[model samples]
Each structure stands twice: as structure tokens, then as C-alpha cells.
Target chain A: MLRTQQLEYTYPGNKTITFPDIQCEKGSQWLLLGQSGTGKTTLLHLLGGIRKPQKGKVYVADQELNTLSSTALDQFRGKNIGIVFQQSYFVQALTVGENLQLAQTLAGHSADSDRIKDLLSRLNIGNKIHDRTNRLSQGEQQRVAIARALVNSPGLILADEPTSALDDENCKEVIDLLETQAKEEGATLVIVTHDSRLKAFFDHKIILQ
Target chain B: MNPLTLSWKNQKDRPLQMLLTLLLFGLGVGLIALLISLNTQLDEKFKNNLAGIDLVIGAKGSPLQMILSSMYHIDAPTGNISINEVKPFLNPKHPLIKLAVPLSLGDSYKTFRIIGTTHEYVDSIFRGTVASGKRWEDLYEVTIGANVANKTNLKIGDQFHSSHGFTDDGINTHDHGDGFKVVGILNKTNTVLDQLILTNTQSVWAVHDHEAEEKQAPAEAVAADDHDHDQDHASEAAGQEDHAGHDHSGHDHADHEGHDHDTHDHADHQAAGPVMKPLIEYPDKDITTLLILYRNRTSYQTLSMPRNINENTDLQAASPAIEMNRLFSMMGVGTDALRNLALIIVIVSGLSIFISLFSSLKDRKYELALMRVMGASRSYLFFLIILEGLLFAILGYLLGLLLSHGGMALLSGYLEEAYQYEFSGWRFFKEELWLLGGSLGIGFVAALIPAFQAYRTDISETLTTY
Candidate 1:
């Protein structure tokens, strides 16, 4: 469901970072391990179509990310690729249900409240659907973020340090939730992290120096 | 989900800042709208009462006061002038004069001026028709104006005594003679005539004539007591006191005969109608002013008549149009200052909107980036900011209109009580629509820079940084 070849990026100061080839089949999970300054977040942004790489291409669901216009790329990312950032960020003014509805609408689809309710219940955050995102607990917010990423049933899920701030027990639980949800949706999951605790959970790994 | 809904949600997030912006803009718009309505209504009232009279001839004084008193009945008349002095112009055969209506003042019944004039003043000048009863014909018979009838409740055959001055203070009243009877009620002309009590010039003369006779009797008795003194001193002192008392009432029974002779000669030379008879036959009688119309207003003689009257005659002549324009310009200074202050307020409110939006945008950058990552385009954020500004403008404009009309209604009640002049607040002016357009322009311009910043939000940088 996702492929990238020779992805390269440069910082403003002309510091260049290169990536190895990545190919993950549909419904498979992969781990991209990197320490700080290895451009792990940059790779996740490139693969999710949030940023364009200087010299390479990213393909998700047989469509190249660089070939789409800016507007079309934003739509495609919303419909096909979901990214979970290091922090649980949300539109603070909206409630949980409304935020999910906004995501569905911004992707040029009509709102599906039943699907949103179903996803939130499966993530164990059904009671938080009417609550503001700011009022939720940290663990509850993490679950809500996961639910939001899968709200549109995207084919690719990119997670950047999703469990770095959690304790070992919570970290295990969060990873279990991500993997289980991705399996249920038949989406390819890629986790970019420096945490050593998640090393034994995935079979395929890409280590960045 | 939509730009408008998002904009509203963002505005609701900071209620105090939004309310402050709306209040400032509303106050600015309200003041300007009040001035516009006041100016429009004042202009309408002034022009409606001007009534085609070319020049006002009165005793020499402030020409504007003369126009206000005689044409508008809002001020005291410039002292009185003898009717004989303007009799030549009053002749219907005069080369330039179209019509001359005499107005004798100096009496009132319950704060309404008793205007002593001929039927020509009512028929030709005001084109007044009686709504009930008939017009005044004989001495001591009077016709009440619409507002006079309404305020005083003086119906037909109601008798009321005249007071000495323009106001009814209960002292200096004419109590010796029988009260003047209300013979007619005039239809509302929406002019100065709507607030007056109309009668022939003789009724005003006769009301003061009784006081004249009583003073003369006391003076004769005092003169008899002074006969024991030097004859010259006694005669001179008596004459001075007597003349002081009879200054406005100088006519006697012999003067009436001479006035009749003059009227006969005037009638023989001009076409005679029932309107042609002099309401007061005494030649030495005084009138407050003469409202004159020209046969051909653009003629050289007509144009020069005011200059001729001002320079050569003892009377003062002022054109109603000229004096009214002078009045407007004099009032314009204060209105112009207020209008400038309102504009400054509007500009300051625009700046306030800009600052509020700019400052709030700093904290919302992360939220905006989240929206971008959720598939919102750059233009979506841009339009959302613009829509917030427009919402403020539209709401403020409506609030301003409501405030201005409400204030005007309150002020109109006071003005009607004080001046007896009608000022309506329910009327709308066309200039208010332009005010709406100007307010929207302010909103759009105020939002321009902030919207551009929102459009240029870098999602990758904002997301990772915040």
C-alpha cells in the first residue's frame, strides 16, 4: 500500500539527509527506527504528502504523492493517508465528534456520524465524543487522536513517536490499539520512533543513522 | 465545517474583544446617522415653510431674525414699522410687486401668536382653506390654526383674551375689552401658519385701542392738575408720557377718516376686490412686517428691490433663501466637527479590529495548521478571517441604525414640546444605505493583512513547532 525510493531532504542550512527504499504491502506493519537528527519526522511528512521532498517520490495506493496538485494532494492525504503526530493536536474549539465530522467534510465527503460513533466506541472513547478535546485526559486524548486518524478509513497510517511520552504499560496499550485498528481497516501502518520498547513488536524494521 | 461557521466559532471564542469592536463601530455609525437624519429633516421643514415669498420687509434689525420671525415664526419680530411707509408697495398695481401681505404682531393667546392679516395673506400667500367654520371677517373675531386649536382646545365660538407679548404670562393682558371669539379653524399647512391665530389687523389694533384710551384719560386728568404750573412744562410732560403709552396705538378717530380717504384713492387706482380693503383703515397704524412676492422674481427691478429697500428705506428686506442658506452654513460648522469625530471613531474601530484579529491569530496558528492538515486549503483560512470581519461590520451597522432612530424619537418629543415644530424619527434617509457600504469597506480593509497571514501559514513548521 506504500512505497518510496531514494527519498532525500535538505534543511535550510544545506544539511542533506537520505533514506533507504521502503516498501510495505497492504495490511502489513513496519517500524522505522531513528535517533534525533536522523530526519524521521521529515520522512513521515514526506510519506504522508504533508511536505514535498527535494528529490524523490512517495507512492500510496498506486498513486504518486508528488504528481498531484497542492489542493488535490491535501484531499488525497485526508482520504487515503492518516498521520498521528508526536503530540495529540486537535482543533481546540470543536468537540471530539465535531472534529471528526470536520475531517470527513474537509476531505469533500458528507459527514457520517454513525461511523464516527462506531470508531470512537472501538477506541474506548465513546463517552468523550461530546467532550472538548482539551478537557480529555492525556490517555483519552491519545485514543481520540488514533480514532481521528482512522475516521476516514484511510489505506496508510503514519505514526511519528506516538508512544514516546507514555509509560511502558501505556505505550504497549497504545501500540496494541494502533496495530489492532490498522488491521481492522486493512491499512498499512508505519511507526517512526526512537523508543527501544517497541523494537520487539514489529518484524520489519528500517534503522536510520 | 464551512468558512462562515468556522469564522463564527472563532469569534465566539473571544467574546469580549468582538464585543468591543462592535461597540466602537456602532457608536461611530450611530452618530453619523443621527446627523444625516437631522440635517435632512431640518432642510425639509425649512424649505416647506419658505412658501415662494421673495423678500421680507420689517423694521431694521438682524435680517435673519426678521426672516425667522416673519416667515418661520420661531423668533421675535424686529420692532414694528408704520403701515403707511409700505403702503405704496402694498398697492396691487405696483410694477414689480406681485402680492404684499401685512403681519401685525405683539399679541398672543396662550403662547400662540395672534397674526393680524388680510384674507389675501391667507388665500394668496398660504393658500389656506378653513377646515371648519369660516375665516375672520369683523373686529374681535379670530381664526385658530390647526396646532393652536389642538393645543388650546379652542373650538368655534370659544372666546379667549389676548396677552400683551408673544408669551402668555398672565400679566400685561388686554382684559378691558370683550375676548376675541374663535370663528374658524385652519387646515394644517405644515408651515408657520399652523401655529398662529389669524384675525384682521383691526382686532389687534382694537385690543390695544382700549388701553390707549384709558391711558389718555389719566393723562388728561393729570394735565388738568398741572394747569396751575407753567403752561409749557405741563403740556410737554403730558405729551411725553402720553406718547410713550400710545407708541404702538397712535391712531385716533380722525386718523381713521384720513385712512378711509387714502384707501379710496388706492382702490380707484387698482382693481378692487373684497381682499383689497385695508383691514385697518388708520394710516398711522404699525405692522410687524410685510411678506412680499415679486411678479417676476428674476427681473432686474425685483432683484434690486431688496437693495433698494435696505439702502433707501427705513425698512429691512431679506431674501428667505439667502438667509436660510446662511443659517445652514452657520449650523454646518458644529455638524462638520461631529461628523469628523465620527469618522475618526470609525477609523479607530477599524484599527481595533485589525489589532484584535492580528493578536488572536498568533495563538491560533497551531489550530489553523491542524485545519490545513485536515484538508483545508490556504484560501479557506483566508476567507474565514475575512468572514469574521464582515460579520462584525454587518451586526454593528444594524445596531447603529437602531440606536440612531431610537435616539431621534426621544429627541423629537422634546423638540415638539419646545418649538411646536414637527420632527419625525421614523423616516429613513437614502444616505444611510451609503453608510452601510462604507462600514463594509472598513471591515474588508481591516481584515486584509490578517487574512494574508492566515493564507501563508506553513503547516509543516507550525505543527512541529507548536
Candidate 2:
């Protein structure tokens, strides 16, 4: 349901960083590996409508987010695109339950209590849901962010080096969760990472130097 | 529970800022309530002075001043008039003129204005029914209004001295006498009478050691003149009733003017009072003001006050209603300005709320983006910022209103007693409600800008670099 053709975006405020084209489609697990300053994040931002591509278009469900009003784009992004930051940032004052509730609220839906309980239980965070997000470890917080992203069942999932803070075992657990959860939700998962360890989780890979 | 609960949770995220906003709202609203309560109290105390009396007769000057001095214990008398003006109207024949109670005011008891008149004035004008004791037994004996008795703590048979001028700080000695017996104490009227000492006109003249008839009697002539004119007009209006044999009317008219004046000339007029023999009937001077109660509403210009004052008659007239309206308009501008300033402050507060919510969003953009990627909508993000603003504004408004009410309650009395004003605590007018709505509106107003920012955040960019 989501695809981008010849999506070109340029990094601002630099004479040397050039625009690049990217193409992607839904229902596929894709890996975008780029060296430092290769515009991987820029491309992702453009795809998410955080920054518009200087040229080309991104179509989600056959509709262009670029063509929609700024307000509509936010709603569209909130409901259909979930991004996981390398360093997870949750609202500090809120408990885990509240953090997820915020995500659901931002997506313009009430928190589904039953679905939330099941998701937390599945993610092994059922007990942590009522605890303050700040009290959780980096790995735990990352899981919370992931749960928040998946709460609305968006069609596209974006993860940016999400496993950087976790050890080898927790990293595997997180990666597996993303892959399996995306498959279950019928979502296209795109992970941006420089780590070779995560390469095996996806079927297709694009490496940038 | 609603989205705004987050701001409440995050209050310490900007602790000083939150406290400052609360303080600003509280202080601003408190000042407003303070000024309002003070004004109300002053108005109340002033109102007490004008309470109960139907009319005021005086030499025409400022109606406000006359009311202030005669009805209230503030300001000085414009001058006095010969009572001949309202005397003719005091005719028992005139169905309308109930009692032409003449009031002569020149001296003051302490800071309270001393009213010199007959027992009729003591009964009707002062409305004192011997709360503690008997009526004035002799010249120089007096009945004190409620506030006066309270301030001095004088009871029946007590004697108190008077002061010369209307201000307590004045150096002049009491001209009326060394001491006047407290023959009567009046209940509190909460009006000008509260600050007065009432005595018979003969006593007033006695203090000056003047023959009573020469100075006091002619003051009634002023009311008589107006009384007679009104009677002539009434007679003309009733001319059609001539066939009904107006002999009763004619007899009443003659007796009305004839008996009172002629009776005083007689030795044993029991209604005259204890010192009636020495009251030394001058029989002409009337009260300081004629409280002209007309059937139709009359304008100040039409009150014949200017004509009375113009002949250098030492008399001026004033309309209480006109002066009061003027006072209200004059005060309204100041109040409106203050309220507007309050509104502007609220708006500024709202803008600060917007800045706080919007700028804070920059740091939280990544989390927001993640949520968006996870099936959250742009509207959801927008609501987060707006709700934050809503949270801040409403909290401020509630606290401000509470502070306002508390301040009013504390200042109500000081405003009334000290400033000659009136104030009611816990009493809110419609204007205060408007203030609340306007204050709360600031949140929404500030929200519009930040909502724009949220709608524009890039979910992809907000996520951290790999």
C-alpha cells in the first residue's frame, strides 16, 4: 500500500552533500545501510513527510502525503508510519502505559485497553506498562517505543539503529520482534543500521558508502 | 484523564515558569478584586449617608456635595438658605408635602457633621428612636446617630464635646458648646446620619447665643415658597373640582399654614418639645436641602435649584442620581482599562504557554514521529500541543479567581468605613465572568501557532541518526 519512486532528497546547508533517489514498496523487509553522511536519515525523513523531498514523490496507499495539507500529512504519518529512533526518547514524566496512550492519542484513537494488555504481555513488558518509562533500561524503553509505534498498526515501520544500546541477545530479541510484528501486521519494515549483525533479518539490502 | 493531564504531570518540567504564570494570574486578579472591593465599600459607606431620606433641601450648589455633607459625613456644606422657599409647600393642605423637616448644618461633632434642627428632623431625618435613652431634654442636649455613638461609646445621659470643623485634625475649638448631653442614641443607619449629631435649631442658635427666631425661623420660608408654588399649581389642576365646594381644602390650607406658625406663638404647644418655651421661635429658616420628591422624574436643571442659589441666597441644590452616574462613568474607564490590562496579560501568558509547548515539541519530535509511524495521526500530535496549552491556562484562571475573591473579602470593610465607599465580598458581577472567558481564551489563541508547528514536524527527521 505504500511506495516511493525516484524519491530524491538533498541534505540542507552543505555544498557537497548531494541529492539521492530512493525506491521502496510495501510488504517487503528492506535494509538501507549507509556510511556516515550518506543521507540515509534524510531519505527516511523525506519518506515520512518530516522533510519534503526536493524532487520526486512518495505515495502511501496511492495518495501523496506531499500533496496533502500539512495537517493531513501529520495525521497520515501518525497513523500509517511508525519510526523507532536509535536512541529511544519517551516522554519522561509519563508511565509506560501513559506513553503508549499518548501514541494512540496522537494517532487519533483511544487506547485499546485489551489490545494494549496483550501487546505488553507479548513484548514481555506487561508489568512495566504501569512503571515510569524513565525507570526502564535503554532496551526496555526501546521496546516501549516499539510498542507505541505498533499500537496503531501502521502499514510502514521505520527503525533507525534501534538495537544499538542492547547487547547481542536483546538486540536479537528486538530485531526478531520487529520482523515478526511487521509480518503479522502486514506492514513493510525498513531498518537503517550500519551494523552487519542485523543484515540477515531482511531479504533485501541497499548499502550506501 | 483528558489529554491535558499531561501538562499537569509535566508542571515541574519548567518549575519556575509554571510558578511564575500562576503568580502572575493570582497577583493580577487579586489587585483587580482589591480595587473593586474598595470601590464597592466606599460606595456602600457613602450610600449609608443618603439612605432613607426622600428629599434634601438646601442652597443650590453641588447636589453631590450637599448629599455628601448632609446625608454623608464627607465634604463641606455649600451654604445655608432661608427656609421660606419650601415653607409654603409645607402646608398641611398640600397632599404631597409630608413634612418640611428643616436641617441647619454648620458645625461638626468631632469629624461628624452636626445637624441643627427641630425634633421633627431628629425623628425623620436622623431616624433615631432612642436606642439607649430619652429625647433631648433641653437646648444643647443632643441625639447622636449610630456610628457617632459607637465611635464615642456614649450612652443616654452621657455628655460629649463637639469639634469646630468637619475634620478631626482641625485646631478650632467646639463652637456649639463645651459639652452636649447625649439625650438620645440612634441605631446605625449606615448612611450620612451615621456621622452626625442632631440637635434642635434653638440649640444651634443657642450655641451661637443668638435669638432663635431671628436666625432659625426664616429657614423654613425657603421650603414654604416652593410649597406654595406647588400648591398653586395643584389648585389650578383641581380647579375643575370647584363645584365640589373646596371649602374643606380651603379650611385645611388656612389651618395648615395658620396653626403651626400661630401655635408656636402660643405658650403651650405640647408638640414643640421639652425646651419649647426657650426654642425662641424664629420660624422662617428651613433645612439645608429640600428633598424634593416629585411624581415625574425631573432633571437637575429643572429642579429650581439654580434659581434658589443664584440670588446669592447661600443655598445650592444637587441631584444625587446625576452625581452618582457621573461618578460611575468616571470610575468605569479606570476599571475597564485595568480589565483590559488583565486581558492582555492573560494573552501574554497564553503566548508563553504556546512557546513552552511548541518549543518543547522540538525535543520530543522524535517520539512524536515514532508514534506517527506507529499509526498515530497528525491531529493527534496537534492535540498534544493544544492540550498542553489548555492545561496551563485553565489552572491559571481557577487560581486567579480564587485569589480575587479572597482579596475582596478582606478589603470590603476597610474600603467602606475608611473611604466612604461600599463593597460586597463573594459577590460577582457578569463582568468577572467575561474576564474568566477572556482569560481562558488565551490558551486557545496561543494554541493556533504551536499547532501549526506540530503539523509541520518531520517524523523521519525527528528519528535519530543511525
Which is the leading candidate under DockQ?
Answer: 1
Candidate 1 achieves a global lDDT of 0.82
Candidate 2 chain A, which ten residues in sequence have the lowest lDDT sum? Answer: A14-23
Runs with alpha carbons beyond 4 Å of true place in candidate 2: A1-30, A42-81, A121-136, A154-156, A165-173, A176-188, A200-209, B6-12, B29-66, B75-99, B103-304, B315-394, B419-422, B440-447, B461-466
lDDT tens digits, residues B1-466, model 1? 6667777777877889989998999989989999999889888778978888999998887898788878888666766778788888778899999888888876788878898888877788878889999999766789988989998999999998888666566865677646799999999988767888998876776666555445445554454432322232223224333112222533533333233223433332244233435633556678878999899989898899999999999889999999999999999999999999999988999898888889989988987887788788888888888888888888888878888898899899777645557777788989999999999999889998999999999888887784
Model 2 per-residue lDDT tens digits across residues A1-209: 65676666655664333434445667788888877678777766766677777667887767887898866776787788887777877777678888777777766777677777777887888999789887998878888878877888888888877887899999999998888888888888888888788888777888876
How many clashes does each candidate structure show, in the order listed?
0, 92
DockQ of each: 0.55, 0.29
Q: Estimate each model's TM-score.
A: 0.84, 0.65
Computed on C-alpha atoms, the DockQ of candidate 1 is 0.55
lDDT by residue for model 2 (B254-363), tens: 43454343343233323445655422235343345555443233555345543554464544545566666677788889988886786566656766777777777666
lDDT (C-alpha) at residue B191 in model 2:
57
- Model 1: number of backbone collisions: 0
lDDT of 1 at B223: 42
